[model samples]
Target: MPAVPGRLRAVCLAAAVAAVLTGCSSSDDGSGTGSGTGSGEPSVAETPRMTLTAGTELPLDAYERSEDDVYALAKAQNVLTEQCMKRYGLAYDAPDPSPPAHIRPNARIFGLVDAGEAARYGYGSVARTGPAPTKPKSAVLGETAKSVLFGPKTKKSGKALAEMPMSQTAAEKKKSGLVVNGSPVPVGGCLRESYLKLYAPTSSSVDIMYVFNLKGEAESRALSDSRVKKATKAWSACMKKAGYVTAAPASAARDLGFSGEAATGPGAVTAAKADVACKAEVNYAGIRFAVQSAYEKRSADRNAETLGLLREQAQDRLRLASQLTS
Candidate 1:
């Protein structure tokens, strides 16, 4: 069958539902609390952990090490001990009168160690689990937003797909039955969607993924139940209150997963799978809104780079969708 188009009007209606329904963040410790296993006792659910092999770089080691050892290491590395202390909420022991000079703390360094520890021992950082701020839908809507949303469907050929402009491909995809709010959107108009793949080395790994969607000049709507909408709205509202601007033209966000050997080799593979079939459409919003929402909601729990990459992809896709639609 010829695909349905995603109409702005329909999208607006859907946005209304979504605005009231999607997005949220978790705590800084990465733990989800709940009842124990049939014990009727309150339980502090532990967050999933990650492991790191030897020769890996770790930044937070300074914070995790003995204060004296860290002090010595910092001095040797030409890092200002006091500044490093402050960054990780430790007491400064150096007596330089004024704060030490040129002690640049690297988030990457800290993150490497933090991630390694989490992987090896299954414990995440408290500060890393805090909720991120919220963002607005307008932040993502750009000059080409309309075109990408209504653009053409994208083919699967590596070269053809790569050669096809994002906006044009989005337009084509809209015509191929991609629906938002139960209406047909014209190819080359205003929205976009795509799929991603993720992998988990062990069944114990959290393997969680998120799918975000944003809309403009319209409220967010939810296709699912109220719980999902409520969670998303809470997350979105938090981001808006935090001062982020949406910068993408169009986009879609989703979490991907894999298991066993597939998770161990390579990272993860991208695949075309139905959203409904996977039961993965927990939350959806515009690109910018979704980015902010995810950051504000899960920023502390996940790798900052991972979140940043996801946001970038969403924004890029949005731009492509707009181009195709226009």
Candidate 2:
């Protein structure tokens, strides 16, 4: 129920790259202000929550998306875009989709909570301790191709959009759109065609992140639950005893000042180990994860219909993707 970093997201922007990108990287919870009746779990009678069995740690039975679902859709969309551009004598090469995190979704969200990471660099962006990833080389496009696939930049503004008030005739508007090769941009624009081919018109409106955001909300709520509060207090005391005064995992990481090359040094490693030790002693993560997971199970049960629709759309898009490639 910890919003998996790559899984939770808002849906409105999904129209542009939901299938491809949500499948790529992630975060968000849509709920506004809580009732704020804080400091404990609600007194209402609760459903008996299940504990983490090997099979039940994640409530995946409600729905799931696999790496294949994302990769296939991305590759297929690229293929379509490439072919469309070929027709207009433009070279189009789509980059390979970014790799998914190797850890479970929850692990990616919490980041350095991974034992290896904690032992190594304490808490910080990996780049704090090590070199950043190399940028992948991308295909180069010509001016015509860029203008055709993306709209032509306005000559006056040097931007994709024109000065709204300055526009007048329909012909000028059309001219502003594209001048691909020697013809108008192919129907629907090359990128739009590729997207339509990979996803349903209706899916353009669906929020890919709804389920994930709900998971985030569950996490937020769990943070305030009485059980979590108790565990957090115990963890805080342990850290304080070690001369590290911090209330929560995030705060501990921050107060440690995990920036620059110093993050990988002796002091940082020592504090990180203590942080991990405290978490284990208090069972803070275990309790929090369990509480949030229960919340997610409840939410998934309640929102099964909408979740099903989103999953089906992803499946359908991937199916089309496969066919397109085949």
Best model number under TM-score: 2
Over all chains combined, what TM-score does candidate 1 have?
0.15
**Candidate number with greatest lDDT:** 2
Q: How accurate is candidate 1 locally (lDDT)?
A: 0.27
CA displacement after TM-score superposition, residue 246 of candidate 1 (Å): 30
lDDT of each: 0.27, 0.54
lDDT, candidate 1, 121-205, per-residue tens: 2212223332342332233333233223433345553221222223433334435343344444333222222211011212322
Candidate 2 lDDT over residue span 1-326, tens digit each: 11211112221111011111111112212232122123333221111221222223445334555544655777888898888788788877777665543333345333244456667666644422223334666778777777667555667866655332211122223344455556666334567556655553443334555666776776777677655566677777878888898877767767778656667777888888788777665555555555555455556656777777777777676677778789
Backbone clashes in model 2, listed as residue pairs: 11-207, 21-24
Error of 1 at 247 (Å): 30
